[model samples]
Target: MTASLPVAPDARQKPVIAVVGPTGTGKSDLAIALAQRLGGECINADSMQFYRGMDIGTAKLAEDEMGGVPHHLLDILDVTDEASVAVFQRQARELFDEVRARGNYPILVGGSGLYVRAALDHLEFPDTDPAVRARLEAELQERGRGVLHARLAELDPASAQRVNDDRRLVRALEVIEVTGRPFSSFMPVRQYVQPAIQIGLNGPRELLHERLHQRVVKMAEVGLLNEVAELETRGLRQGKTASRAIGYREFLKVLDSQRGVLQEEYSVADAITDTVVATRQFARRQITWFSADERVRWIDFTDPASLSHALRAVTDA
Candidate 1:
């Protein structure tokens, strides 16, 4: 299983291979293949996949799908635990060192853009003030994301431009308030923290859209509702990060309708439609994020030579 890949003659360390792309593009499958061929361990960089019992919706790899390769940093959080990129960066680096110590290449794989950057780039997170964060959260709830985002735009245009969600918007404002500096100051540089190689998978837009639609449909067919219902019992609704996940949030609305709480007739099919739209949008954002990085070597997901090209990239690194 341990096929040797070429390294620089004076290379001091093994290069961490990152398989990154939008969802449904077979990033996980490629990561597994690389790990199997290189005698490497796969590290989960997909933020949502950190949660336990989120399998069906997140398209988490099943045990058999792992192809007997050791995977780390998955299923390590509860439904109620808020995922932190800072914490993930620490954990991922630690796992990287451990995997390298074992004489195996560490492969980082996921579509979560910031988490991937935090793992491979020179990123520094600012400290958080609980009071400042709470105040921002309150303002977010009261004045809404648009207003808060405008405020961020006034204070830190760069950070505001990059932030797409309420959580990040709030965090950016909090960082500005806490440090008396622009949140963009903490943004990651393109420089890597260590030796690394990134392989990005992509394909035709129409094909990716169709794949996303089918994937969401498959999630529904395989009992994503049941999975969400189970997580709901375990405080999924109370978890700030977990509750906002694409499929989980949509399904929760369906659950609310079933309980006569929302007074709207939201069916599973409706949720599926919403999830498909949201997932496609998210995939687009992911593409925008990863494509900005020139360090990533692009490969067509539909190309039969993708795996071979990826292997060559690693060997020729």
Candidate 2:
């Protein structure tokens, strides 16, 4: 049974509401419910969901699932385009204002922790030097990702732990080299740029892990391979961000096996297993990221009163 969400009182100022948590924690469903109750629009904070052809693996909501609510920022980029946090911050802030201007609450949703912070927090990015970046990229190619990551870990351990991909790893090292400052120093403070409420959904670790595995299996069953194959033709392999996505990356190995590009045959079952492992790891990282922020009000995702609890957080804010 679902608890009824309380009606939002009429007020001149509506706080920005953020639905944040790990993957497969029902963030999107809760976001839609909040939007329906609060007369709000959802602005996506998921970095991968921005890619157009990534629907199945990313678990993107179809039109019918949106429940007639306006959703922003999903499918805004092609798979080949790299996602930029600075660019996303600017665009999301603009949407926040626009949504509020129309007398609607802005509901930000996704498990991408940094993206969520960029949308709501007082964060700033350092300028990048093309020469320095080129040098670093060349170094990465020559020395390999492990070597560069080790160097970054030595320079800024916090940034090293937070950065999960080669692109971000390179960028962190670039920031250290160019600005003479640790990349972690530029991370957002807990303070929000505007009045906001963050509702976090979490459950038992075992339950979350099981759900992630089931979801990966379901995605594979529902044409995730075909989706990856189609995107590969559209330059998904060349995409610095998209190519590294959990499920897509695993499935691409199967595609390579099919094409005889690799000596070993990678099966669909192999892809599913790898994807489940990667997704669970990613979810753990997300939990760590969001849990560190004390401002987030957590509710048990499995609880029947979760929606009502989330609504109360918004109303109390």
Per-residue alpha-carbon lDDT of model 2 for 1-317, expressed as tens digits?
A: 12223433443268889999999999999999999998999999999999999999999999999999999999999999999999999888778777776778899999899899988899989989989889899999998999999999999999989999988998998899889999999877889888889999999999999999999989999999999999999999999999999999999999999999999989999999888888988998999999999999999999999989998998787
Q: For model 1, how does the per-residue alpha-carbon lDDT over 171-203 read when each residue is reduced to its tens digit?
A: 998998899999889867999999999999999
RMSD of each: 5.1, 6.4
Total clashing pairs in model 1: 0
Alpha-carbon lDDT, every model: 0.92, 0.91
User: Using alpha carbons, what is the TM-score of model 2?
Assistant: 0.84
TM-score of each: 0.85, 0.84
Q: Which 10-residue window in model 1 sums to the lowest lDDT? A: 1-10
